[model samples]
Target: MGNIPDHDSYIAAAPEAFRPVLNHLRDLLRGALPDAEEMVAYNMPGFRIRGKVVASYAAFSKQIGLYFLAPAISDHAGEIAETGLTASKTGVTFPPHKPVPDHLVKRLANASIKHVDD
Candidate 1:
């Protein structure tokens, strides 16, 4: 992808296998953070609140990543582990066959929104 301007374009430019996953994640984020301003930053789709990015999502060759603040990941460590998804200090990554659950995504998004200023 080269300088994608928005989520629609970013998703369209992604690998065909990942488009649906990206779209699902986008809807989840929008619902979870209705007050957020949608934008593309760092060449990825993200949601911002009060000018601070609270959540973002990206698709790689083999997996999709949903990124939030570090504290949100840490806070949900146990839940993420139970889901058998891979997570770092700032994000969760899962193969297309094993997506992060929708409920979990919403929880993490809400947590990220809450901690936007941290």
Candidate 2:
């Protein structure tokens, strides 16, 4: 796809390719950080609030990764297993070719926000 200037543009430009995942993620993030500001950071889609980086999203070659602002992978170890997330200290990667589970997104979004406060 073409180079999208911002998150909204990026998602809009690749609607057919990114609609389902992007929309789901967007809604979840909004729910988690109701007043967070949307912006493009690090050349990717991101959310922030009162100067804190709340979350970010990226569409890579083979997968999409949603990164939390803090490191809390171990906190949700059990749930992560059920969600089949490939995680790192700051985020979980969902293979692009696969579908993103709704429950997993909710759990992760909650955990991520909690991590921000912790």
Candidate 3:
């Protein structure tokens, strides 16, 4: 993403088709992790708490990926499956047209924060 400095720039640099989805995810994460520090890590916009990254989102050519701690992803596996999205041990990839549900995003963000705090 070319050394983007913040979420705004990262979203601005993303493909037009994915901008709204990225913005929406950013909002969801921000609200869910209000104490988190907003930063660009690994070239992606992410939320960090107590020196640990709790959540992050990125835009790609074909899909948007929402990343969280591996335990958070595993804990919510069933909810993610219900959304019909593909997920790895640490993230979920979904097309912009069918973004992950906002409630689920918030839940995952909180779970991720808890995982790190513990």
TM-score of each: 0.97, 0.78, 0.97
Q: Which 10 consecutive residues of model 2 have the lowest summed lDDT? A: 69-78
Candidates in descending TM-score order: 1, 3, 2
Q: After superposition, which runs of candidate 2 have C-alpha atoms over 4 Å from their true positions?
A: 1-5, 13-15
Best by TM-score: 1
Quote the positional error of residue 110 for candidate 3 in Å: 1.0
lDDT of 1 at 117: 79
Query: Pairing residues by index, what is the TM-score of model 2?
Result: 0.78
Question: Candidate 1, which ten residues in sequence have the lowest lDDT sum?
Answer: 109-118
Candidate 1 wrongly placed segments (more than 4 Å): none
| Pairs of residues at least 3 apart in sequence or in different chains that clash in candidate 1 | none
lDDT tens digits by residue: candidate 1, 19-50: 88899999999999999999999899999999
Q: Candidate 3 regions off by >4 Å?
A: none
**Every candidate's lDDT:** 0.93, 0.70, 0.92
Rank by lDDT (best first): 1, 3, 2
Tell me the lDDT of model 1 at 57.
94
RMSD of 1: 0.7
Using TM-score as the measure, name the better of candidate 2 and candidate 3: 3
